[model samples]
Target: TQLLEQSPQFLSIQEGENLTVYCNSSSVFSSLQWYRQEPGEGPVLLVTVVTGGEVKKLKRLTFQFGDARKDSSLHITAAQPGDTGLYLCAGGFGSYQLTFGKGTKLSVIP
Candidate 1:
């Protein structure tokens, strides 16, 4: 069975702190997507890195796809209260069903 395992499922940090979340799997993936969700709202796509060793940055956030395409990473710099949310990683092709990670809940305090 395809599965994505995420680490440090819960995180709380003060404003201006840095944090990193990880997604790992034994199966190789074609692509992976990162999403952030708030209460009462669906997850919003943060980024998708298809190629191996690819890295994309959004503001203070950075996403990296593993060389084997079976793992990924997210790093946030100078986190703010607005960053508090649930972070999810999905692995698979868009045309196919994606397997989601357990999710990481982040809380950024002011």
Candidate 2:
């Protein structure tokens, strides 16, 4: 089974800090999706990039898909307390089930 692996399983930062989270895999995917999940709530979609080397930005967060489609990265510029959550990256297509990384939990303290 294919899977996504995330680095730095946990992170703690004060408000207005910057951080980067990584996701990796051995298989290529047609598309990739990034989601941010809060405690006791379903993950909310942040962005979906279909093409390799695609980059998308939301507010202070930037997401990039590796040119090989085997990895991705999330870079946050000047993160705020609201950015604290579980950052998840998922890749797959159809109903085959979306594979999610172990997740990077970010805590931005005020």
Model number with the top lDDT = 1
> What TM-score does each of the candidates earn?
0.96, 0.94
Query: Global lDDT of each model?
Result: 0.94, 0.90
Identify the runs in model 1 with alpha carbons over 4 angstroms from their true place. 93-95
Compared with the true structure, what per-residue lDDT tens digits does model 2 show for residues 19-98? 99999989887788999999999999999887899999988999999999899999999989999999999987554657
Residue 59, model 2: lDDT of: 86
Backbone collisions counted per model: 0, 0
lDDT of 1 at 47: 96
- Deviation in Å, model 2, residue 43 alpha carbon: 0.7
- Rate residue 63 of model 1 by lDDT: 98
Worst 10 residues of 1 by lDDT: 93-102
RMSD in order of candidates = 1.3, 1.4
Off by over 4 Å in 2: 93-96
